[model samples]
Target: MAKYANGHLPARDRFAHWRELLSGTHAPMTLSSERADDFLARQHVVALGEVTVWPAVFPPVTFRRTRELIRRSDPESYHLTLMLRGSGIADWRHRTLRTSPGTFHTSDSSRPVEIRSWAERGRIMMIGVEVPKAVLPLPRRLADRAVGLPVPDDQGVGALLSHTLRRLVRDLPEYRLADGPRLGEVVAGLTATVLGQVTDGESALPPHVHRETTALRVRAFVEQHLGDPDLSPALIAAAHHISTSYLHRVFRAEDVTVGTLIRQRRLRRARAELADPRWDGVPIQTIAARWCFTGAQFSRSFRTAYDMTPGEYRGLRGGDGPGV
Candidate 1:
């Protein structure tokens, strides 16, 4: 199993560790006496780290000093974070951020800002990307404000981006260096899209790329919720905070219907079970029910999608399997 260290490390040491990683240099952070270690975990994905922390342990401790730390970190090189696990208040310029579950705050390293996590232990997950400023494509002022601010979780680009980030952190191995630049683009695009900052007259996006991103997200969502029989078009749409019509549009653009996609996915899973000899004795009806095919209708639907009945497929495998 992957090892993880959970606890605090002194702030100066933590700062120096991150600085060395980001700068690719040997300079160490200067600290008189600062302690800030909440929890740190080695990310499952390469080129990234997963950290959960509360504001009380943040570097510099004081708001003014924390601002200086941000400046030293070089936001252009690392994307700092504000994620909340518990209810808390964040004080950012002109904005009093109420950090609730699902709150996400990102800031550029160069900017100076004060953020306070609410009284309750507010938790955050930070994934820093080593990217240059030239590629960010946003004005400094806008970027500063946009960072450390809440982006609505209610769908459109934001939900997709949030889902992608969560999945990336959860399934990091699937990404590669070749994917880094493109991932950065998606990150910037979604950030801009959610912030309503995408300018007019920009070149049209490639339909294939657009379709691929959404399709990947749809597939990921399906895979993640396989056990939920109610994961239908309406539910999927709701999950993404998109209207059913818009969800259908996404499917239609990919040359499929929402219902068709779901059934195909269910049948494909059912077929694998029916074919696997290990499940031979686990009654065919039970196997069907396990995949959400609870009745004759589902059984018929499965047969129509795949040529063999579930029982026939299981029977052909022999009775060696006793349970799922």
Candidate 2:
């Protein structure tokens, strides 16, 4: 991971420095900002193989890639932007899109595009990923349809992709440089999945990408319905319109069964609530039920996992009092 900041630079050189950095990190582009004279910005970049993830905050600015710039040098890649806290307008291929928080925008390096963004209150914050077009598993024609399109990141595959990007950025510090290629594969796979969903091109993805995407979707579903007692492999399969056996096969690569994954997540959630002081007044059984665990079963599982019963663990964590 690499970090860049312009706060220490001379005020007159801040925006210019920012422009140069952007050109190197992303593709060559002309940047203009009304606050150029005193632009304040910081960027964190993570290079995962051929794919690069950049999380940045900067003053309101307009970035444009002209035809001449494309002619001079084009990475032949697609740039995806996930807006975290900002509003922006993008113009590409004669199409215009207005984007806000929790939305996504895409542009092609081989094409001319213009994006003007402004902050809601503070600096505009967003995460951008540069994906080589050839690296995506989707067909060229289908993937091209997603370029210059603005989509919401709050639903379906988009939500999963958004979560993955944010988690990667947040946990980058914990990853070793040697993990780049593997991490790159994950990001690229999700990018393909998102583009496939957007362009109705899922049928074209390779088997491996399909399996990984399905597993990701299943994990997301499990997280959403963890509190439901009826959550099981059969229900999960039915929700995704796949057979139970197929669901098992999807998770085989993960080295854990679906049932185990659900149980582990539930136990983790229960443990967190038990240790939180705010839940001190809540009965242990009630807390257990909240996470779909019965009283006896909860105690046994908690003891097995943490080597302590729920009451003991709670007391050790400074809860108000222990519970049976």
lDDT of 1 by residue, 256-302 (tens): 89777777787778778778767666776677677787758666886
lDDT of 2: 0.90
Off by over 4 Å in 2: 120-122, 318-320
Q: How high is each candidate's TM-score?
A: 0.54, 0.94
Per-residue C-alpha lDDT of model 2 across residues 1-324, encoded as one tens digit per residue: 889999999999999999999998889999998898899999998999999999999989999999999999898988889999989899985788898887788888988989999885968999999989989778888789888676679988888889988999988879999999888888888888888888888888999998998999999999999999999999999999999999999899989999999999999999998888888999999999999989999999999988999999899867875497
C-alpha RMSD (angstroms) for model 1: 7.3
Pairs that collide, model 1: 8-37, 9-37, 75-109, 75-110, 88-118, 89-118, 281-321
**What are the lDDT figures for the candidates, one per model?**
0.51, 0.90
